[model samples]
Target: MQKRILGVVGSPRKNGNTDILVSRVLAGASSVGALIKLIRLGDLDITECDGCHVCWQGEHCAKKDDMEELYREIIQSDGIVLGTPVYWYGPTALMKGFIDRLVFFNSPLHRGLIRGKSLMVVIPFEETDMNTVKPVIDFFDRCFTFLEMKLVEKLVVPGVSRKGEVVTKSEKWLREAFESGQKLGSGLT
Candidate 1:
């Protein structure tokens, strides 16, 4: 069976710069024969993870929202990609909320189901400098590590301000993302 890659566009803006960049990465993964699925957060009714801790008991979130299905999709995936826009030096509010919901996968009971998953992060920010991007990537790394996931690559596209700048042109950072996806999708490493 082919390895599955789940690309989650955490930005609420559909097809925004971050979305397009992640799409390119997932497209490259598809080119390599990986099963790829791209989900736009804006279209989902994912609620913030309240302190309910309901999912810890192996129960779905009590909110009965789209997040349950999203989590199920992620549990079935082999590779994961997170796409987010930097706002005030961090992931967008929507992305943070989504990440918060991932707490369920951190528990030991689910580690067997979620461990060894490959992970990537795509950050689209107005700052193009690597130094400026490091913190954002660090945050993503922490999130992935918390789930015991293996993070292989990250794509931080800087100096992109407009919402749809990615569709008009590709950035050098995209090469790394595409290649990362190709390598992960190949499922050899």
Candidate 2:
């Protein structure tokens, strides 16, 4: 069976660096026969997590929103590619909200739905210092670690601010992103 990869773009700017990078990764995955789907959080109606904790009791979240569909997609996907531009040394507000909603999977009843899935993260930042992206890396490391998900790859591009920079000026990083996707896609099979 072909592996399914979900590409979630957390950047609000469509066709921006994050979006392009995420698409490159998905394109790479597609080249290897992996089924890929892209989801732009900016286009969705994902609300902030209400902290109700109802999902902890094996019940669905109290708030009805697009997250319900996201849960289903996540459950069906064999791998995920999460791409976001850095905002205030962390993920964008859109990505953060999506991450918050992922708490539903923390429930023991739903943990199995996410454990062992492959994950690839793409982070593009405007800062020139490599250390500047550490917080973003650390944040994802903790979350995926706690969830028992295998982090297959990470493409962190620093010093990029303007749109299309990844494609225009960062050929090396773009190649790395594609290779990361190839590696991730091939590994699943």
Candidate 3:
């Protein structure tokens, strides 16, 4: 069976910079014969974590929602590409909530599911300053480290504010994103 790559778009605007970059990455992965699936969080009903430590005790999350299915996808994927736009110098709330619910994977019972899996992060920001995306990258860095996941690549596209600007304005970064996906796919094989 072909390896699976899951792309999660945390941008609120469909077909925006973040989504386009993610699609480019997934396209590259597909070119390498990897099965690719993209999920837009803006279209889902994922809720925030209630600060309940039940998952830490090897129990399930207290709430029932789209994340149950997302968890399954995450488990099935050989690689995951997380795409998000910067908001207030950090990842969007949608992305943050998704990350929050990832506490389920923190439990020793489920930690192994994520260990050694390939991860790619695609971040698109409006500001010209690269520092604008630092917090977002840092958060993912910390999370991936704690989860024992290998962060294969980070495609950060700065100075992109409008929808599809990344595509219209920068061929270099777009090529980089595709290359990162190729790397992720080839690495898995």
Candidate 4:
């Protein structure tokens, strides 16, 4: 079987809370023989999106950096699993920066290629009520919908406050995230 899943971890901290959850989900996905590549954006030499419209000229973003490599992977994968923590009720800077760079995809040049892909989101938060996460959740959901992609699973594990605390403590939710990854690895319905 060909490997078909790509996991992107958008945390500035390598061993941060979000990274652990991302690792666990990848591990579970690998257990089922899915090819998994975990890209930790924090280690890359990336830059912010300058809102350049170069993507309209071609199917690729003109902003040069490590993100160019990631863009290739995004197009190659059958599924995209994003593991990110919400900061200030939104996506962390690392992820927001990457998404902003993807502004090129919003151009008509690349419209047809990115459509109908599958995405899974895993989020760990410190909010007291999981409901507070609605803002960020809806943000991602709407983006994917606008891009014409399918949302396979969304796991929001709240109440994890300490550094590197979510994966070990969120046994139940982590398992659910793993199962969600497995489901995504099986391909779209």
Leading candidate by lDDT: 3
Instruction: Please list the C-alpha lDDT of all candidates, in the order they appear.
Output: 0.81, 0.88, 0.89, 0.79
Q: Candidates 3 and 4: which is better by lDDT?
A: 3
Could you estimate the TM-score for every candidate? 0.91, 0.96, 0.95, 0.92
Question: Residue pairs in steric clash, candidate 1?
Answer: none
| RMSD over all Cα atoms, model 3 | 1.4
Clashes of each: 0, 0, 0, 0
Model 1: how far is 57 from its true place, Å?
2.1
Report the error of model 1 at residue 170, Å. 4.5
How do the candidates rank by lDDT, highest first? 3, 2, 1, 4
Instruction: Tell me the lDDT of candidate 2.
Output: 0.88
Top candidate, metric TM-score = 2
RMSD of each: 1.7, 1.2, 1.4, 1.6
Candidate 1: tens digits of C-alpha lDDT, residues 1-189: 688999999888777888888888898899899999999888888777777876667655667888888878888998888889888888888888888877777666666778888888888887767777777788988877777788887777778888888655665666777888898788754
Candidate 4 lDDT, 60-113, residue by residue in tens: 777678988988888888788888887888888888887777676678877666
Q: What is the lDDT of candidate 3?
A: 0.89
**Candidate 4: clashing pairs of residues:** none
Model 1 CA lDDT for position 140? 84
> Candidate 1 or 3, higher lDDT?
3
Clashing pairs in 2: none
